[model samples]
Target: MSPPTRRSPRSRPSPEAAEPNGTFDAATRQQIDAVVAALHELYPDADCELAWETPLDLLIATILSAQSTDARVNQVTRDLFSRYRTASDYADADVAELEEEIRSTGFYRQKAKNLIGAGEILRDRFAGEVPRTIDELTEVPGAARKTANVVLGTAYGIPSGFVVDTHVKRLAHRLGLSAETRPEKIESDLMARIPRDEWIFAAHALIWHGRRVCHARRPQCGDCGLADHCPRNGL
Candidate 1:
């Protein structure tokens, strides 16, 4: 018998392809489409806020962004990226020194550890290059699906899945698009309702709305264009 062949890293299937079909009714589908359209009009240039020059930079910045803001992560990475230019640099870095370097980001010990371990994996397994697929990218120590999606979609222009950060999760529920709280479940709900091409932009636009308008403590309903269509669930 022939051994089962592994799929090429570049050919990783989009989340939209694997999601269950017909999750949205005709009315609901129209509502979601309208919501997405409004968001596009409001934030036509929405994109990843984290600054990165390469996939490795994005991966590292994303890992550091856990429980932290993108502004904070970028502040830390300005010095961090300049010091460690490549995955190999991180792989060979002193853990103690690295921890101190990223201390301001909070959870420095774990973040530094993940950075080193991920670097080692990249150097050993993927020839010191960032993997293009969600499956392969998630193999790095700090990268879960959220981080992988950020790197793949933002860095490589591959729409692997919708990025479900805190903003996405909160906005999804508030807009009545997703009843779930967990990021993964919320992402699934969104993928089922939103079109394939809009996945990446949708995440960025939602994130921008959450940050600029639909704030956690005080969502500016009057300032929001979606206020009319939104069910305002849990708000």
Candidate 2:
């Protein structure tokens, strides 16, 4: 898809568009539509950056991604996946050995514990299969709403909710798409404004945009195609 035409500076939202009161009025919703459209144009193929071939791989990678980058998680999983091929493999893994394998991802002890617990849950509850629904997925030790959303949308094509990672959270605030502080609240705001069909794509696009352009610090507003639609909140 071609990028959206850059809006003239004069057409940009006024300072009042920041909407400090946090209301999703007509104008705010319209701006959201524009932002979503621009995101589509900018990242038509955006997807979960984590490398995974199976639902179980994605689930484990998402857990490892907590407090770590996708690149790092992928590096660890390359060797880890080869050794632990199934839920039972992880369930039977030695905690110390697993921790050493994923040590580079940080918080290795807890992450290893969570992974083992997740494996046990998957093996016992789901018959060695990853759960499809959010509730069941989240029941796994490390799969929260964000992780579950990633697994559901990316693996099963289920639009359960928006994946509110740090990048999505930052971009949502900067683009004036959500004024909420908490991840769940931010996700709720985005889900309300963004169409269900576009939920998965929108989250991926926002994450890509956040990483590529709209950084948490030193956001490249000048090069942003959505700058006109964005209110430049907290810039």
Candidate 3:
């Protein structure tokens, strides 16, 4: 009998795709397309779940969303946006009051301080507005890859990198698209596999998939549109 053929790294998806969600090995091309198409069918209009009236809302919400759900972040920011419209608003927010308001989001004390600091930086450095570039966004007190991804992708229409949220990180692994365990490493892997053009929306699609069908605790793989294409189908 012939020995089983071994696939090469070039034959596997890149450690990370590009800025747009493109490029993949043969196995992954169809799989990614199927995942994207399903998202198109189910949501049809993939968008950011964090509620925001302006760039600053999205930025602050992204900061607050750390270790929390977007729904909960939105709940906390329901009127938080109306009251704190600019970076300076957060800069001036009474520390205790800010902590109390954002207390439900978890890690309230840290988040509140970061919010105030980020706002202060934005006001001083960028004139009270969020920056458009990743470098600029990262200058904020609490901004990280995930937060920067949100700000760069949603607020500025810039796709510097994939957003590696809990959903993106998990779905990427389950879909056999990336092998990295850490979020930054996974983002790097994805940047090499996916095309640059689809980066922003691709993250959104995977996020929606992770939430709706590919749940963390119990993914509904049986009903998943990409079941056949999913290597981790039973997950």
Candidate 4:
């Protein structure tokens, strides 16, 4: 036993690495409520920024938004949507042409492939309509839990689960609302803490706050509305 093998600094668990137990006491619940109130006040009009007129439009836009900004996705979809109005249109699209259409979205090849696959599934399995349930939506290509949640909540007004995007993930940790690293686990913590009715609104509000104030690289803590309640965890 060579002097009790010392653990390296890098190997040590981060201060922010505590895992949420998916349950909260009264005090914690109150804090969560306060945070929700703050968010409501901060972003009263918080909603999905992606431009879409139909469930299929939203489903495609959300899928296109992966690793891309909403603004960019919106721009691309403006033209793409006009060209491909239905699932059958996408299912029949040429992969190379589709790739070129969404080339600026980054990972165009894969995105195009997923879009085609999703379109085919929606056309064949779902009768050319976006599925309402998370399980069904996740069956489409490019629609993982996050994307499925977005489609379900925003498109169908069903709070299947919280949409744990990068912004939500960052805000969850910084606000000390969750201590989990994985999005699914973090979503579980959030669902446990936030009210069922407020699930959809909370996800949108957190996203807006994260984009406007709690930025990833340089959070404007001074301008943050939740500054008082925020423990500034892992800052």
For residues 165-232, write the lDDT of model 1, one tens digit per residue: 88899888888888987777788788877777888888989999999999999889988888877898
lDDT of each: 0.83, 0.82, 0.79, 0.83
Per-residue lDDT tens digits for candidate 3, residues 77-179, read: 8868767877888999999999999999999999999999998999999998888877777878888767887777887788878898888989898888788
Best by TM-score: 1
lDDT over C-alpha atoms for residue 60 of model 3: 86
Off by over 4 Å in 3: 1-27
- Model 3 lDDT, full chain set: 0.79
For all predicted structures, in order, the TM-scores are 0.89, 0.88, 0.87, 0.89
Error in Å for residue 195 of model 1: 0.6
lDDT of candidate 2 over 96-185, digit per residue (tens): 999999999999999999999999999999999998887788788988888988998998899878899999998888777778998878
> Model 1 scores what on Cα lDDT?
0.83
- What lDDT would candidate 2 get against the real structure? 0.82
TM-score of candidate 4 against the unseen true structure? 0.89
Better of 3 and 4 by TM-score: 4
| Candidate 4: stretches off by over 4 Å | 1-23
**For every candidate structure, what is the RMSD over all alpha carbons to the true structure, in angstroms?**
8.0, 9.5, 11.1, 12.9
Model 4, global lDDT:
0.83
The pairs that clash in candidate 1 are none
Tell me the tens digit of each residue's lDDT in model 4 across 64-114.
999999989988988898899899999999999999999999999999999
| Segments in model 2 whose C-alpha atoms lie over 4 Å from true places | 1-26
